[model samples]
Target: MSFKQLLYILLFFFTVSAKGSFILIPMDETTQQNHLKAYGITYWALDKQYKISWLLNYRGGSFLLPDAQEIRKECQIRGVSFEVLSDGESNSILDEISSPSQNMEAVVLERTPKIAVYTPKGKQPWDDAVTLVLTYAEIPFTPVYDEEVLSDGLLLYDWLHLHHEDFTGQYGKFFGAYKNAPWYIEQKKNAEALAAKLGYGKVSESKLA
Candidate 1:
């Protein structure tokens, strides 16, 4: 059979036979091949309209997905580690999570959240590890700055990430050493301009406000 047809057939069988079963992708170091790829798989599943249960603090933040051959195939293709759990086993996991001793919790992901990163406009992914990982994993994020935040753009995103930012407005602690550096001078100028535009006397005031 053609690959497409075979995939459809396997999907049908998997959906029927694996009802109430789940695939768990643990984020522990045991998944050394590519722990990040597990997140990519979860994103892919979200794109496919699959609901995911994010098991926070469980096995180092794992994912629980309904059993599907397509998802399994994607995990294998991406080299993400996963395990299938029967209904009983899944319940046991929940039970353990409910116990007082565990720090586990769950969040249901019904849709892909809009992510925003607050960083300088001219900064590149190479300058920030979080941006690099998000870029490499094919995750989309909007880059926002002081202007955007002041304009209420922050309301548009479900998640926000900050990088290399000095909210204290001390110019990233470089004022005492690299104050004369061109890059530091530019950063200070930009921040001061923004602060002035926002009616603040100093960048630190604007940031703190």
Candidate 2:
């Protein structure tokens, strides 16, 4: 091939390779289409063994992930807004975030945290906002109640979300208004039964233990 042909070939390859090396998901209120789904995307990346950087205090704490077609497709499917940054551009952003004067840091995130929701089984607590959001985000979390907690099951998970929970065993002080509600009656019955099975005379005592 001629020298001109070789030059053109190299230029084409450089342009293609420099198009995008990083996926930047801005978490600011004005730009992000779906903030929660963006989190889902990060979780998805972590689950796939991708090491991502959380840009703390940068544009409201954005995420930096390696550019991949699969992740672009996921962001499109989940309605999460993102931007593609070339390698030089990505490095510049990181450098700005890493400066001593800037109040920002890029925290590396590699592990997918195992989440546990402390909620009573058969208590119909899944309808709550937190669980609903988690479901919508497609994030998997285990539901655990007093039974699991009493047995040291909490040690198995990395993060715990409280759902209609009361460690004091006072039923969240719902007695004044929900005392006549059938759900309230069932809740009291279940707590008492669980406490008895756990060898405690009162639910409060079981909870304290």
Candidate 3:
């Protein structure tokens, strides 16, 4: 899901002390396409130790959050679309979702999962979409290479994203067109160096291992 969608979900969680009404953050919009910013806000909420419920398949997976001034400010700052719902209205929506015919379900988010990316040490954000999103969302993640994986760094993370890497060792199928390019040559050299440093004769062998 986009970061904005995640943020909208996080903003739905309300503390018992909150006195305001419930807020509904809608995701089915085209004008204000700030989903990524919403994601950053969600990460911010997670950092503040808030719990959230994700209403799946409900109005494009809308979020039900306790209405708070801080959350309102955040929504405004991020340009996210939200509506305040009274207690009765909120409960009614929940009731509708509970109907057997509806495919909606609520998933409570308790904690943020640790994320990792399996990528080269020198790869840039322009080289990978996952990394770009993670960076934009301000989500913390570790970068692990073949050597780190071989040494069991995978145990440190609950989630992992592979970044433009080929386990089959074909160099990402770009060798035919850009084999002579400086960047390609540098990439090949880096791979070879890493493989040699890790006691592998070839980059493909190390990647496969």
Q: Which parts of model 3 are misplaced by more than 4 Å? A: 1-19, 30-32
Candidate 3 global CA lDDT score: 0.77
Top-lDDT candidate index? 2
lDDT of 1 by residue, 33-86 (tens): 577787888888998999999989888888999988899898888888898888
Query: What lDDT score goes with residue 49 in model 2?
Result: 95
lDDT of 2 at 199: 96
**Model 2 over residues 66-164: C-alpha lDDT tens digits?**
999999999999999999999898999999998999999999999999999877776443556788888888888888877898889999999998866
TM-score winner between 1 and 2, please give it.
2
Candidate 2: pairs in clash:
none
lDDT of 2 at 98: 87
TM-scores, all candidates, are 0.70, 0.88, 0.82
Q: Report the candidate with higher lDDT, 1 versus 3.
A: 1
Q: Point out the worst 10-residue segment of candidate 2 by lDDT.
A: 119-128
lDDT of 1 at 183: 88
Better of 2 and 3 by TM-score: 2
